[model samples]
Target: MLVAMALFALALERLIYWRVTHRRARRALIDAWIQRRDHVSWSALTLREVWTRELLARLRQPLPWLKLLVAVCPLLGLLGTVTGMIQVFDSLSLSDSGQARAMADGVARATLPTLVGMAVAVVGLLFVSRLEQIIRREDQRLHDRMARAVEDAHA
Candidate 1:
């Protein structure tokens, strides 16, 4: 749910940027963005600058959450395994049923949470890796454009 909302926000940001960038009033707006360079503003940058900023921003967002999720999975698995073993012990206290049968049921019951945790972790991992690469690419693009802008300024 959170991931989807983040993605939606990213999309909206892109849409807003694209809309503003294509407007005939871009020169005036960019001039404004430049003159207001108190602390947070970039002096004057290309459309590429804005695009790269958005991409890099989106890329870094999910990594911490993904790392935390991955770390939690193994803990949940261990917890499930421990509880399953406890159930086996409880079953062992009975004379009619064997410990093996109880152990099997316990293992099965515990596996569900482990699977869910691992699945969440895996999904996070996959997306985070992809985002990392994209962010790097965006950063590189920004650098290239900045370099060109610097060259133009020197000229």
Candidate 2:
């Protein structure tokens, strides 16, 4: 369940990145800024700087939660490992005949969650890296677009 949740968050982040970086979305954002220019007391440059900062903040808002999930995955796996080991010890005490088989099964179960958690963390890390790149590129594009919009408004 935790793995599924992490994957879902990753997918959502990718979707958000795609939406934010799309040409149409970028244009719309700039257009909105242009519309608001006359209403605010701030100068065009100041407004642009504030808008850019806000945009980046909104884009990055979900990142910490996603990172938390990623970090938690391994700890959950460790918990599973501990529980499996406990079960193994319980079986060892209760059963004398099939001790080896029980221990082997328990060991396999113990390790599987760790493997799964690490795998999910790695996948989430990849998504986070790609999102970071997108954010950087979009930040530059937004700045350039806002500058042009300000220049046009001045002219």
Candidate 3:
């Protein structure tokens, strides 16, 4: 479930980035904003800053959820570890003949989830890092373009 949520969030972020960065979509948004308000009083610097903030907020909307998922993964693994240990104890109390084998199997089960969870978290970190880089680059590009557009409109 954690892995599925992470994948979904990643995909959503990518989709948002693609839509936000698309030229036509951005142009249309700017055009609508212009149509709704007076552009004469809005300075290029102010408009640039506002657009930058807005776009950055939109880009980062999914980050908190992703971070939460990353945090929860290890916790879920810990839960699994606890359960496996319980199973180990239960098995130990059950029989004298296969005690060692049961304990070994339980240990394997316990450790596997921890390893898998940590691995998933590492991959999620990478994904988050890459998404951040993309957002930063796009923010800069959008700010420059908006600044130019605002300047041109004012002129």
Candidate 4:
């Protein structure tokens, strides 16, 4: 649950970075760099490539952790299920007669954790997919703008 929340927050932050807050900053940086005559040889394609790499790195930084956590959620659920089953088996062995209630309770406990884990994983994955899409679009846009900035500088 906590991991899922963190992933959601990361997705929101990325959305704000590209859609709300960073546009002006990006344009200003590009303009300032282009206006500097001394930096002409730095070249537009070169600048674009550098910025693309940096932005891509920043954009992709959280993805591996997000994927790992999402993947682990299911395993955690499975662990809960296994533990619950063990409890059920233990209760059965200890009781001379069948402990139907105890077994049922254990089964419920086992299933609940798996369900919770899967739920968290599903939610996390949804956010991850959206974040990736946004990142890809933003990356392309950044590349396009940087290419134009390079051309403007040369012009």
How does each model score on TM-score?
Answer: 0.52, 0.79, 0.74, 0.75
lDDT by residue (8-126, candidate 1, tens digit) is 35444544543454232334433444444342235444553664455456546546655665566657766776786677666666657666765677778867766765665676566
Between prediction 3 and prediction 4, which has the larger TM-score?
4
Model 4: lDDT to the true structure:
0.75
* Residue pairs in candidate 2 whose N, alpha carbon or C atoms collide under 3 angstroms: none
Question: How many angstroms is residue 149 displaced in model 3 relative to the true structure, after the best TM-score fit?
Answer: 5.3
User: Where is model 3 more than 4 Å wrong at Cα?
Assistant: 2-7, 10-13, 16-24, 29-42, 147-155
lDDT of 3 by residue, 40-117 (tens): 465844764676677577677787778777777877777778887888788787877766776788788878777777
Off by over 4 Å in 4: 1-25, 33-42, 147-155
Tens digits of per-residue lDDT for model 4, 56-151:
676678788888888988888888889988888888888898878877877887788889889988988887887788778877877677667768
Candidate 3: worst-modelled 10 consecutive residues by lDDT = 33-42
Worst 10 residues of 1 by lDDT: 22-31
| Residue 125 in candidate 1, Cα distance off native in Å | 1.3
Cα shift from native, residue 143, model 2 (Å): 0.8
